[model samples]
Target: MDSAFFSMIFRMKYITRWGLMRSSYPETLSEHSMDTAVLAHALACIGASRLDKPVDPMKAAVFALFHDAGEIITGDMPTPIKYHDPQITEAYKRIEAEANRTLFSMLPDDLKPYYEPVFHPAKEDEAYWQYVKAADKLSALIKCIEEEKSGNSEFKDAKAQLLSMLSSFDLPEVQVFMQEFLPAFSKTLDEQSRE
Candidate 1:
């Protein structure tokens, strides 16, 4: 089989994030996925280590890595437009499902099983998927912070809105992460180095 299919997935690197906003720094889907994976891992670890939950950081990390793989085909839709209406959201989900299916088809039959679980997990993984969702929001929040750090006021409202959305989740792990790590994003590099 030709390796052309893999190239399509790698094209995620060219998809810019925050397409609707004036960003101080351009971010790519590939970059965001990696950040989300790391954040998901940390959130999962926090849940397991401190919250007495049996969360698997590695699983969460892997899930987060491909959480937006569908976006490679659909392009990164702005969150506001993506969630503004119930109908639109539902339609977009269907589009994403189709995209995932297309992505899965790219791999050889022998390798499909391994990739499927990453893009589409079993029902039992629903609980853990929450952590991936939370990490996605946290990653956005971090992006807001980064924009603010760049002296760009465009993200000020976004930062507040993201914080509100995250707070509404009220997940113990998210709360813990916000308390212990989120504040650090606001600090200077020197301050972080000292700590």
Candidate 2:
């Protein structure tokens, strides 16, 4: 049977993020996913090469790519509403799981096993998952930085919150990325080129 899996994946471009706030430059899920994947790869590489951790950069990057695949089906739920209450958060998690299952089922049966670990990560890859989570937060923080740089004060609170959340991770690789790479996001293209 033919699969609609790739077609569904392409629909990621249609899902806009930061639904509750005004954005200086609107972002699509596809863009966010790509950013997250890049960050995840960097963080994992930092962990493995610099920190002597056994993280797989490629695996983390691939996982990060699909971290929010469920959001395509559920639509982008505003963060405030998604976490307003404990029960609501739990309910949303269930809904996201169901959405992932539905998306996974779109794959051809022979390919399902290969993609299963991405949709439902194995326990052994829990450490790598942490990297993906950090990457996800970093992506959001980058968005906030860009908005603020564009003179959009709407994301100020979010920038602070994301920074705090990332700080709490206490991962050396994350700290390194924040220190070494994040500041560049606020620089002008000319300034970056001059450096």
Candidate 3:
């Protein structure tokens, strides 16, 4: 009898196209998760040090790593398509919830309890959640930066909306990063940020 060994699966992506990190353009789920985890760690440390709000950097990183594990089933939905309206937003959430269910189900039903904490994170750990959300935003922002630098303004609107969303969120350290560090993102391309 074969056991359900947790091994990575190399499957073909059908409908979903485009992936993370333009440097490695058309990256994969595996690649995106790796970047998200590492970036989450760095952002958590920045938040703790500069904002005086300490976070469990390691746990936050883990959260980021698994944040899109659900995508293994649902596939990456482009932001424009995902957020076109409240109906679409709700539909996407439903898709995510189902993917989350599928991931835990991959474990022995009896052993699923152990993975719960990591998969369905607690909002009670506010700082960790903040890092997860910030890391998500940052990854998209980096993608946007790369697009703009490539002379493709396709992501310009997304960059602006994401920056606006980040602005209204009361995360002081993120706010500071946007003000000071973000401009450098564009200047690195020999151009100033459009916003």
Best by TM-score: 2
Over the stretch 67-180, how does candidate 3's per-residue lDDT look in tens digits?
A: 777776778887667778999999899889887776676677676676786667666866777777876787777767877877876677778888778777666767766677
Could you arrange the candidates by TM-score from highest to lowest? 2, 1, 3
User: Cα deviation in Å at residue 152, candidate 1?
Assistant: 0.5
Write the residue-wise lDDT of candidate 2 on 1-195 in tens digits: 888899999999999999999998889999999999999999999999999997889999999999999999999999999999999999999999999999999999899988998998899989989999999999999999999999999999999999999999969999999999999999999999999
Q: Supply candidate 2's per-residue lDDT for 165.
A: 98
Q: Give the TM-score of candidate 1.
A: 0.96
Q: Spell out the clash pairs found in candidate 1.
A: none
lDDT of each candidate versus the true structure? 0.89, 0.95, 0.69
C-alpha RMSD by candidate, in order: 1.2, 0.7, 4.9
TM-score versus the correct structure, for each prediction: 0.96, 0.98, 0.77
Tell me, by lDDT, which candidate is best: 2
By TM-score, the better pick of 1 and 3 is 1
Better of 1 and 2 by lDDT: 2
Off by over 4 Å in 1: none
Residue-level lDDT of model 1, residues 85-119, one tens digit each, is 99999999999999988888888888887787877
| Per-residue error (Å), model 1, residue 128 | 2.0
